[model samples]
Target: MIDYRRIGALLAGRREGYCLPQGLYNDVDVFDFDMDAIYGTGWLMAGFTCELPTPGSYVSQMFGKWPVLIVRDKQGVIRAFHNSCRHRGSMICKPGSGSAPRIMCPYHSWTYEHDGKLLAAPRMGDDFDKSAHGLRPLRIEFAAGAMFISFAENPPPFADFAEKLEIYLGPQRMDRAKLAFESTISEYANWKLVMENGRECYHCATGHPELARTFPVTMSKHFDRANDARAKEFVDTMTANHLETEAIEGDWWQLARFGLNRGAETLSMDGHHMVRKLMCEENQGYVGSMRLAIDPHCFLHATSDHVFMFSAVPVSPTETLVTGKWYVHADAVEGEDYTVEGLSELWTRTNLQDKELAENNQLGVNSPGYLPGPYSRDAEMLALRFTDWYCNTARAYLAGRTAMDAPIHVD
Candidate 1:
């Protein structure tokens, strides 16, 4: 149904390093046909590790359109299981999160351990082996403080993926930060738009005045993997360990960028007490700690003191549900200062800015008169890369190819 060779050419490009025409962003058909590029194949960070801090914790989450459950077993190892009942395919867990030694299917009361081992099922003939009907398990891996699950059989290991993209992520992913709060929203634009918008900071010069006041726009350019040779070498180092961010600089935005002096903090062994105060003065209120990423479909904003990740899950070609999770030190959260209001305000503002623009832009693209607008190279790169990846991956899926099975190319 699609031309794989032509799609590869669009992604490979002739002169733009790597680029695609604007039609990908405008076509409704593209979204409908290629939904799996996002919902399938590549890794997705689902259900934060902190949410399942102890053995026997389980949560119901969705992998794109399919529902999934992640559980921590008695052995303290986490596992992913399809949440549907083995009998009528009814959903087993109704709650979003909780602790249970064995998951009881609501429809027929079949039971499975948190590790996804099928322990017992109701009403089956004696000859039916419960072991053969265990809840199906997915490939699972961890990076820093977060966890990722993939449905594809034998998906690439998290360590292998990270090792290929090394230095980009410091040493470990910032997963240890305890979750303090979560914010969820239903966005009206495509999920890819949200991911693309967050990837580059070029928009900070205008659309994000608050962020611009904190970090230089140049940092976004520095982050680009195309022009920087160090970036390529760094990605290689990362793939060696499975790409994960090792440190939380201990500061959020403006304060971290300026207060530490880039050179001193660049190679420093510690980020302890990363920030005494957030970027804004008391009048603006301390913005609070955060971690940032636009990987796959996630826009993660994190800090050692707090962590929040926003993902736009596409409900259809035009609608997406945006969800956020907040994390903090276990003590800070269970104790006195775990309010999500301060950090939430900052995220909402930035999120609304993009939501407003993207939804309106979508409407315009729906009209027949829309034309390709000139894009600034920097802020636009994030969106551009998403477009490239979306088209390329879709074609790859059509051809039965995948990011994991592709030739390793970090070097």
Candidate 2:
């Protein structure tokens, strides 16, 4: 049996400025708890609006154990629903992108509208209520052009984070963008390892040579920007260009715009725009990359020419699926405006390197002599924050569970 109290204690016992206990990385019970407590409760980035361009367009994917189907209705509204059919619980949509006038269950021919209303149920009695058998709906919200869904009964407020996303990403005009390319890679590492590796640039200099060519790795290190002349100058330049320069962070999200290396326009091998057409109409010259991170699942980087989105999906106790999506102007043609190889090279290489690193890290942690080590105070602050958030969230969930399990006295 899993000991909830012991798990809570383990989370609460984490030392500051250090990595988590070894068991937290490889324990099956801990992984299951995380699926329920963390990913289950948080708002996850489902997909972008461009993925479902026309009415009836939809994409289905598994968020933890929840099969999510996101679709555009006849009225042009984006909607989400549990992919399972209302009848015998078969999946209405397969795991990928497709288009259909209505969702149909291949097993029994039960059909549902794009808005999740039950439309046709053959061979059912007149007493059967179609209204009562509609598909189960999930809570969904949009920020900029991306869709976020929460499985929680009462999810956290997204208004503030949505506002921040607009401030940083709205300028990109993602509504007019298209998903140019996408790829998913399986890593033999825990989800936390993949996230911890992404939350910092401590390994970029030594591990990602291609990314370092254009990206300013030092900008990721935590420091007092107000007193730093370089930071002040960059902010001034961006402000003069009518761009957002400040960084905004909350408990579960962070958004910031940072300058690239000198003479670099975007994140590319040649330091030039990959797409011939710019993403934002007002962008006449170089505009820094706007980076946004939503806790527990995804991170996004939008440049003047394109946007790159990354999401880490937990697969098992010792495995994660890291998916990358690249978006560019909808009118931009593949060969004429941008090539897939050029558009995805920098991040593609970096992700592969990080995958190897994370797998190796997990292997070391699985050893008997493995112990938590100190995180670099300056370089690994983001990683520290992520770890802290995970522990705090887990402890809160465990505390709630304990309270519910406790015996009540007669009044």
Candidate 3:
């Protein structure tokens, strides 16, 4: 049985600016709690609209324990479904991307139309009501060409998030972008550790030399940015160029634009354009990077030449699936404009390095002597923010569960 009281105590006792307790990182019960309270309730970036470019296109994946299907219907409207057939709860779509005129359950041949209306059931009696047996639908929304979904009946407000996304990502024209390359790496680490490693660049200088070539490692230090003349000048230059320079933050999301290292246009090994076709309207390169991060699951970085989408998904108590997708202009040709190797090299190398680091961290955290450690205030502010958000959200969830489970007496 899961220990909800222990989980609540751990969350309530978490120290500010320190890493989470060891149990929070390696406990199976905590993992289940996170899947229910965090992943189950929040909006997650499932797939891009470009992945569903045409009518009948679809992508299916397991969001925690929920089998989610995102599809573009015959009317070209993107939709999300629970991905389960109503008859026996068997999954209707296989994992991965494909184009299908209708969703068919391989187990029982229960079929559904593109919009999730039940079409046929081979063995069911004529009295069966197909209309009431349609696949279950989930809440879905779109912003800046990216698809977001929620399993919650009443999801958190999205208007503010969508408005901020448009301000930061609209100029990139992600709707006109196409997936150039994609990869998923299994990291033997806690999902929080995977995200914490990504939220800070304290390891970038020595750990990710390839990424450090184009990305400024020092720019991650929030305290240093205030007094750094170069950082201010970079923002000034970006503003003078009429680009979006605002840094917007909310409870569960952040949107900001930052300049890359000198002479770097996009996150390439050589600090040059990886694709011939630009993503935005900028005539020249060096448009900098626009970053958007939604807590717990999604991170995006868009440059003038291309865009990168990342998601850290929990597979178990100590395992995470890190998926990365590289996107370029829709018209970009493989050999002439960009090669898959060129478009994905920098991030691929960086992701592999991070996987090793996170796995090692997990191993150490699993040790008996493990204890939470303090974060560097300057370099690890974002990491600290992530932990704070986790604790607060988990506390709220546990409180609500307690209230719901409490017995009632006759009044």
Q: Write the per-residue lDDT of candidate 1 for residues 1-411, one digit (tens) a residue.
A: 544444444344423434334445544554544455446665677846778878888878765567888888888888888888787898888638889868888777888877676778766878998777888887777655467777666453456444332333222234444555666666676666566666666665687654544434555432433455644454454344343323322111110111111222111123222223322221122222223443457755443234457777676666777776755555553324534555455556767777776687667756677554554565565555555566555655644643434432211
Q: State residue 315's C-alpha deviation in candidate 1, in Å.
A: 1.0
Model 2 residue 21 CA deviation (Å) reads 0.6
lDDT by residue (tens digit), candidate 3, 52-171: 888999999887667899888988988899988899898888779989888888998888898899999886888989999887899999998888999988778999999888878888
Off by over 4 Å in 3: 222-224, 406-411
In angstroms, the error of model 3 at 364 is 0.6
**Which stretches in model 1 have alpha-carbon errors above 4 Å?**
1-29, 154-157, 160-176, 217-220, 224-294, 401-411
Q: What is the lDDT of residue 285 in candidate 2?
A: 45
Please identify model 2 stretches exceeding 4 Å from their true place: 220-228, 281-283, 407-411
Backbone clash tally (model 2) = 0
Query: Which window of 10 residues has the lowest lDDT sum in candidate 3?
Result: 402-411
User: Per-prediction RMSD in angstroms?
Assistant: 8.3, 2.7, 2.7
